[model samples]
Target: MSEPLLEVKDLNIHFFTDEGVVKAADGVDLIIERGKTLCLVGESGCGKSVTSRSFLNIIPSPGKIVSGQMLYRQQLPDGTTTTIDLAALDPKGKDIRRIRGKEISMIFQEPMTSLSMMHTVGDQITETIRLHENVSKQEARDRAIEMLRLVGIPKPARLIDEYPFRLSGGMRQRTMIAMALCCNPTMLIADEPTTALDVTTQAQILDLMLELQQRYNMALLFITHDLGVVAEIADEVAVMYLGKIVERADVDTIFNAPKHPYTQALLHSIPKIAMKREELDPIKGMIPNPYRRPSGCAFHPRCSQVMERCKHITPNVTAIQPDHTVRCLLYEDMPEQVTQKEAMHHD
Candidate 1:
């Protein structure tokens, strides 16, 4: 009944390269509620990482958010709530700087690259705490050590003085998690934080994140391409193609009754444990070139259920049931889609 923690509508992010503008995130919509996990799942280049980065107004150079509202329901210290449009703020300004790590923090894909080799792990974590809170050096260092302990790192007091390169892959990632949570952020954006680790370590990191999410009552926007990870940690799943989200639903429906052709194809692509290696059914065609996107539905070129209308008329996002939406011509005739379909056709 309460407003969602974050709501994004028609999020359009583009990269203006000399060759052409790359439509990285075109008309992307997302909603993340408090204390829940929303997994943005798609193959590489589907705009998952870019979309998450936009929350912090950190879209890399040469690419920027062209339009869209990132409405964050910020809880004030006095218990009242205020909505702030993160997309409109200056990326280098103090407002976003204050909120970036304190209210919303991000864990990048690779810890080795994300963590600074020059600084001790403790210094990096303490720096984040000192920046947000009016705390002294000793106080911040103590807090950092406590966070390291909380994230399951052994001998935190000693390891805190060590460089990132000295730690194992899993340990470095745990330190990243500790750093992200040091500020007790309201929401955490993890961009494939576990992809580089082995299966056992990945599972451990996933469990740790879920545990911490519950402990902190923080919303999580996890970006990943692994369906297995999605099944393990996601409450809701959004399937992205190119720059558009083709389907979104609760984890069960996304895996079981996915409506969009692309979603179905993606689900089919997952290798079954008992199935033979040759039986693996990967998606049919390569993703289209971004500079020369196909006409109408971007997936039509490879969509097995493509229709004549798909060649020219883009499909509207249609809700087949409560809390379930799919963008595909096959669902265009659904009663809920009539109005949107008409509008798209008119355009």
Candidate 2:
């Protein structure tokens, strides 16, 4: 097997403020293979976005990555691979700048805020292409228009001249996609790319993303709260709570045989069309304030299967089966009992 496209181990990021320090991402571990989609699913503020931003060292001011390694296996021009530690590089330094956009790019959550209203969409895309590639202005413009067409933007020749505000929500998102793919990056990080669109438009965007991922053969780090979207796009799913990944497995295992209470709650919360008579089972309580996260398990306060150990001792992530891991005490002592309970609940 080939080395993973990207691997993160024990990544910890924090935001320091006058109020308190926000432990945004703590001991997060993830791996993304080439041409695969890894969905980072969790409620808001679970560190999904922060973790993805760490890839490019783009975390905003007051936030710092305290420790951990971001190993990127870069494919060199000579067809060999070089492993570089991205976390060690200066965020705004030349090395990171060379890697960003050229090898890896991101599409942020909101296109309105991500795109500049003053510039034409075409110019923005061309700027990104020129920033990474040594191309003439005319060549960059031609490539930008081609990318816009590739992303399903209609009348690319005309739309390229319009500012972001002139485009609809979906069109703006496609523009963002086009910009991110302008360099044919090896990896794409999309943070809730379809959250603001209608269902039909959301589906179209998702399909476009999948199609582009296939065409470019790029690894995708998709961060979102939508389980339906995960089911549709993710080959693997990681369930995050507070600042930790509570569970991770293949999409089928995550949805059907989830071990952690938090994972089960999230899955249960998804509305089902077949259960017309059933009420939505939203997760109880709310994500705790990052400054004062709950002791032991961060999800313990809201976990239905909570135990005494959960309130006092943090459970280590344990493997329930090959490639399936969960961080919960319920599986530590009586794994069978927890499995039976999950089975009964599903039935």
Strongest candidate by TM-score: 1
Task: Please write out the lDDT profile of model 2 over residues 266-338, one tens digit for every residue.
Answer: 9899989877645889889988988888887889899998865567667787889978988887777656665
Decoy 2 TM-score against native: 0.94
In model 1, pairs of residues that clash are none
lDDT of 1 at 72: 96
The regions of model 2 sitting more than 4 angstroms off are 274-278, 333-347
Predictions in order: lDDT: 0.92, 0.89
- Candidate 1 has its poorest 10 consecutive residues by lDDT at 334-343
Off by over 4 Å in 1: 334-347
TM-score of 1: 0.95
Across 44-119, the per-residue lDDT of candidate 1 in tens digits comes to: 8989989999999999989999999999999999999999999999999999999998999999889865689999
